[model samples]
Target: MFKKLKITCDEATTICDKNQYGEATLLEKIKLNIHFIRCKICFKYTKQNMTLTKIYKGHAKSCKELKHCLSDTDKEVLKEKLNSFKV
Candidate 1:
């Protein structure tokens, strides 16, 4: 018998969050993958999550370099602007 398989948004989010760090079990990953395959929104979400994670990791690797690359004048200007907003 073919039973209905429906996953909730909260369940999908939980699965995606667990899979983010490569810590999910094989069965969990497989179930999430199946759900993703059947759900367009979940698929898009998973794709975006993967893309953002990659971007974040790449940016993290060059964070020190990125900071150093900013000109002193730019940094000073940003700091002054930020200070003006403090209550």
Candidate 2:
């Protein structure tokens, strides 16, 4: 019963990721929802994950119409940005 449903935060996070990609089973979803009952932090994490996925899906659809590669100038700018980020 309760013992079967009980999951650690790590397992909960994994299940949450699986759920994002539609890989989680119905039982896993049930267990995760049960986990949310007592764990606010994991619940918050799932909410944030869902939000990010939603945003990414919308952005990806728009990006499909855009170019697939950067130009020489664009590559140079990106290289400069990366070099600036390095110590």
RMSD (Cα, Å) for all candidates, in order, is 7.2, 8.1
lDDT of 2 by residue, 11-80 (tens): 9999999999999999999999999999999999999999999999999899997878889999999999
Report, for every candidate in turn, its global Cα lDDT versus the true structure. 0.77, 0.94
Q: What TM-score against the true fold does each predicted structure earn?
A: 0.57, 0.68
Predicted structure 1: lDDT: 0.77
Stretches of candidate 2 exceeding 4 Å from the true structure: 67-87
**Tens-place lDDT digits, model 1, residues 1-87:** 112345676777678877888887876676677787678898888889898889887897888565546889999999999999894
Worst 10 residues of 2 by lDDT: 63-72
lDDT for 61 in candidate 1 is 88
Residue 44, candidate 2: C-alpha displacement in angstroms: 0.6
Question: Which pairs clash in the backbone of model 2?
Answer: none
